[model samples]
Target: MVLSSHARVITPVFSAVGGSGRSTVAGLLATGLAAMVPSVVLDLAPRLASPWPEWSSAPGAGLASIPPHMPLSRRQVHAAAGTNPAPAGAGWQVLTDHREWSAPPLAPVDAPAAWHQLAAVGGWQGVVADTAYPMAHDIVAARTAGRTGWTAAWCALPCSVPVVCTAATASGMQALQTALTAAAAEGLPVQRMVLALVSTGDGRLPAPVRAGETMLRPRVAAVVHVPYDPQIRAFGLRDATRLGARSLQASDLLVQAVLASAHASWGDPLPAAATPAALPPAHPSALPVPEKVSIP
Candidate 1:
């Protein structure tokens, strides 16, 4: 299927210090986009492990066991589907690298090729990759060895590719800025970076912090703040995917605005209230809702 002019492929690389809610943001972004267009969410980080059963519980979520050395084909991916079904309008695939993180380097060539393959499947209009944090030096080395996967994935035309950098605090943002600066010095395009300020409290980003993000925005395609919501914890526990509907909505709006500002087509407006199918009703006694916890 041919991609729409609004097709946006993003690869969000989190910081090494994990637990900063990077995966949560990735999931929300993917779900949000799916509400609007055909999208694919790829989890590329090996360390942030997502259990298969939990993902399967969410409608439209599927797992694809992609070999590190092998390239995935649309048919191969479709064939990998098990009992879990894909969400409507989009699908989320968790690609695991069973090998040691350090053992299999991030093949630069495969990175971009994977995006192309995803676009080929289901005629994706957007692709969002949840990258691993503190990327191993070997991964960086592979990129240096002529792997432009990250660049190729986002640099596609008629698409607005933005890398959402999630930080716990301003200090974390500074450190990210430093690393991004170095990558720029090494010839990585810094202009494509967009900051997604994640608030750990009640999942709400304060106005002041939002303003602060704007102050430091770098060629910012758009700035998004993810409020600290308890439902994020439910990702593995229950079918709380709907809990993030609002967050996903906000994220989609930001992405749409970014694409429009870049002069790329924003495709058609999202369908009104397109919710993914709810997971089979679990025994209420089997899984009880947990008390809301304060955002850190």
Candidate 2:
């Protein structure tokens, strides 16, 4: 969607299918963006399924804890989400699902509204949301992508990208293709798809797979290759600072791609710095019209 540089961008990291390491990618993207700007990761998965710690359960935490649709300063966001040192003292924060066992689970339908409220809290350069795999009609990722100043990231194993190219004629890809087509038809624009390929080893795809990705390149806004590191799995998706050298480099590459995609997709560069401004009121006009923005 096309957004002015002043708008707050919210991106969702989702997988075409399960076991694609979507959450890991989302966390890395959030931490990476935090290095350049004030950013927050919002974990909207089911309570038990969220990978991040139950930070929302802390005193005065939870989505409800943040005032609804209010313009908050940068200090308020830092105080609410808490600060962590990553990318050398960059303030990255995370918010998770309501942790109270007695509390009713969040209704899927209310997700967009909840995210809107959180964005209104202000002081964020961007919000990276970790969405559950879309197996059902919820299509939360698509909903986020369709909004103005937002994008959707589809994470998958590195092998999966080649598989899409090599096995396009295979029946297995039918469901995935159909899903993607439907999402686009429903307003999930292609300019918003950050195709993140997570690698578990040396971060190299097979030659044939690489060619396949090249053939499929035009379908996505950008492709990021992430090296696999055990620490990511061991720590249950820790901060970027804890990543190893190769993994850290991969994270930086992925972040750079996302930022570039945001600039092109929104038709403006990433904001030079976070400013404390009120979020624009929600309306149909807020949805950006699709544009053919090229990704470098």
Candidate 3:
């Protein structure tokens, strides 16, 4: 399989409806990518809804400190990112909030290219975003007066490889279908999207999930499952580095799937490189992109 250039930064998105384990998928993908190169996760979840600060090992300026509509330098980005404790965050970082309770949720991506602006910082090779949704709104929210300015209200840039997250349940599958339909309408390349099915329990895939995967198999680039790990449920991402072996394997596949996507997006030759954990082969599915959304 072709590898990444390891030269460019790509943000794989987990921008699905609430309760879809977006952060879970984003965190795993970031950690997996970090195993190869410097990587970070941009936590775009609103404060009350975010679980990041509780999971962080140290403290620093939380998301509320991000300079709105301003381009960030590598130092500025890292300063806001703070240090990630797991893996000693040797090669991984999270740009999220860590302030005390009662503070405000940081503003959304208010810049026209706010997400891209933050991602443009050069130190990392990949950025995984846990973005807010009802994307139709998020897409046009930039057009708002900023409550009164020419500036764009911050928002998530289009994902290089958008992974639609959902639980493996009948209801979850239904929401997944709705999200895909909505994403497609927003010009997102749903055909090239990846689906991360987070299992609700241990052992075999529930019949509903199996059926959902079968139905979506033909429309998306690939479908991967993230088995539920009690460790994470009990302790949050603070224990993510110690995920179960199968769960880790799923994360590896996730990383490969996105890498394969980046290679296709660039249509450039990518060579192989050693990785921390063995990864499964990249499916490398390149589907027809729609007319509206542009993924680069």
lDDT of each: 0.49, 0.55, 0.65
lDDT of 1: 0.49
Maximum-lDDT candidate: 3
Sequence-dependent TM-score of model 1: 0.62
* Model 3, span 89-125: residue lDDT tens: 4546787778767876555664335555566553565
Which predicted model would earn the best TM-score? 3
Residue 50 of model 1, lDDT score:
43
Candidate number with the higher TM-score (1 or 2): 2
Over 4 Å off in model 3, which ranges? 1-6, 69-72, 85-90, 110-112, 134-159, 270-296
**Residue 222 of candidate 3: its Cα lDDT?**
85
Which digits, one per residue and each the tens of the lDDT, describe model 2 over residues 5-102?
45556666655566667777776766676766667776667777765653322322544454445444444554556444476867577766445666
Using TM-score as the yardstick, the better of models 1 and 3 is 3
**In candidate 3, how many Å is residue 172 off?**
0.5
* Each prediction's TM-score versus the true structure: 0.62, 0.67, 0.77
Write one digit per residue (lDDT tens) for candidate 1, span 14-59.
4424555666666665555555565555555443264432454432
lDDT score, candidate 2:
0.55
Residue clash pairs of candidate 1: 7-125, 16-134, 60-86, 60-87, 202-228, 203-227, 203-228, 204-227, 204-228
